[model samples]
Target: MKRVFWRAGLALVIALAFSSIIYGTSTLKNMQEQKKAIQQQIKKEYEELKAKKDEISLVYQEILKYDQQYFEVQQVLDVLETRLTEKKTEIETTQAQLVTAKEKEDVYYKNTKERIKVMYEYGNTEYIAVLLESSNAMDFYNRLEYLNKVVEYDKTMLRRLEDIREEIEETEGRLIIEKAEMEHTQAEALIRKNDIENIRVLKSQQIAAANKKKEFIESEIKERQREEALLDKKIEEHIAAIERERQKQNNNALKFKEGFLKWPLPGHYRITSPFEKREDPFTHKIAMHNGTDIGAPNGTPIYAAADGEVIYAAWMNGYGNTIMIDHGKNSSGQHVITLYAHCSSLVATKGAQVVGGQTVVAKVGSTGRSTGNHLHFGLKIGGAWVDPMKNTKK
Candidate 1:
């Protein structure tokens, strides 16, 4: 009876244990499903957010394009204005010359007319009397020669004055035509400026709309900051690795002339951001900008800052498409490196040699953590990041 009672109790315990195991398994499965659903929802929200940000990004690109165009047009307008000033001066000078020529012609004409009038008043009798009063054949011959010389001189003077007037008139005509052409060109440039202004106004409206969603943009900027941090680490590691290789190779020979670095993006010298500590664009916190941000149109060619070997040309986390060149060493025996980031596309491949101010290393872009199209240029020396503008000055 005791053995049977013990077996019954053992069976009851087994049943309870089995029931608990099944319930635990079921609960675990349900929890996993819930977690997966949450993950899916989060992913979906992220995608939606990305889509909205991309739409705004496109608008920003358009604004950038128009801004670039406006700059170019303004440059053209400046040149035209300068040329017009010069043209006006030239026209004034030509007019002065014309007036002088006219004055000379009028003086000669008045003198000749006075001479003719005096001779007419006196009549042919005077000439007849002088010739008749000659003493001999030699005297008459001398008198005739003198008369012929006087007539020739008068004719020559009149003809020369006519030629002078004609030449001056031709010059005036040519200048007038050139001035008109310049005016026409100036008008066209002004028209272009007006058009650009109108477009700018439209862009301003778009920007205002974008401002309405500032919260979203601020969030995106935070995301970019995180990515930028990661990219900064990657860049430092890359530079270190390249430097190590260079040191091992003992390739410390200077590869370029000692001077200020070439401005990487030609015709785009406007520094959108500097390499100094400033309040972060969106975060409102003090942050150090590691590089100089040069505003440029998308796809603008980015040249190598100095003669160097392309040690790295690949996609980085937040820098997007990047190109790094190792410029051997500076006069101080410090290894110099230049980095160009946020490229639309890279032209120079890894390990390729490049010439400063000549090689098209990459194209400008708004890739990675960028808010607009620009060239983010960084300078590294002796394994430390320094202000590029300061280094260039050195």
Candidate 2:
């Protein structure tokens, strides 16, 4: 029809510059393998969080050495129950002094059996009838000095009742050897309180096996943080498909100026928030504030709001140190991308091409899901997102 539509417009401009160099070399090879899988998932959750904090601090120092030996076996069973109540009150005062020394040896055996029944009923004929009823030689020498002082006072009261029955059987054999040594120290303090309750039940079963191996290494560090959040959503879907194929090959060298785009933060910025339904300055909620922010400071810089090429720089996630670019299509066919997000670093590199207001690339930060040193920016076109204040540049 017209040289077959001019070779299908030169094969759609060489298939849009070979799909923008294969989506910018597969988005810088999946963001350098997602930064080496987030440094091997933070070195395996820091060695399983230091081996579960050193196995719960050695099972809490072996349950404090079995609770300090069960408080020294309850202080030796309270001193063997206070020496078994003073050995049962010294065996009841040695059995009340052996019943008062057998009641004073039965009152000296009833006065020595009534003086041996009056000398066996008149033994020496009552000692010659008391020397012929004494009334002569000075009353028979006073009846032989009163019968020899009544037989030496009944043999000194039977030798003091056999020495108080041998001192009450030697004080009841020393109070039965101190009540068998207080019942053998209360049976060795109840066998050392049952061997300290079996060593506190085997140290409480080794502190429940160290809290079940620290809950299985904290569920394998939450499954490696869900595989590093699916590798940050596969590096943000390959940097949004290489910024939509480098904005369809910079849709014919876009150069727009007055309101077509570009004021991506150069001098005195301000914006603070605009894109749309506000709020969410870091999940304050509401929602759709997709881009715009601004407020720069800590490091500031940033630029490239148009020309574009760098299909993405690096760490993205919530958009920390990002980049993106690709500015291209306009009139209606939409494509133009932009996005600068929380930066604070990355000085244009990914695919590098930049231009617009002289690509400074990135700086202003507060990193990902930020809240302070702003700059968010963001934009897009064919792949959706619209109000970057509808083409920026107020």
Candidate 1 structure quality by residue, lDDT tens digits, 16-72: 323433554555455455555545655665676676667678878888898899899
Give a tens-digit lDDT track for model 2, residues 160-258: 777876776787787678768767876886787678678767766766775677677667667766777776777777677777655546553455432
Q: Which window of 10 residues has the lowest lDDT sum in candidate 1? A: 1-10
Q: What lDDT does each candidate get?
A: 0.75, 0.70
TM agreement with the true structure for every prediction? 0.44, 0.35
lDDT of residue 287 for candidate 1: 69
Q: Positional deviation of 260 in candidate 2, in angstroms?
A: 20
What C-alpha lDDT, on a 0 to 100 scale, does residue 116 get in candidate 1? 87
In terms of lDDT, model 1 sits at 0.75
Error of 1 at 208 (Å): 5.4
Local error of candidate 1 at residue 369 (angstroms): 80
Per-residue error for 71 in candidate 1, Å, reads 2.8
Give the Cα-based TM-score of candidate 1 against the true structure.
0.44
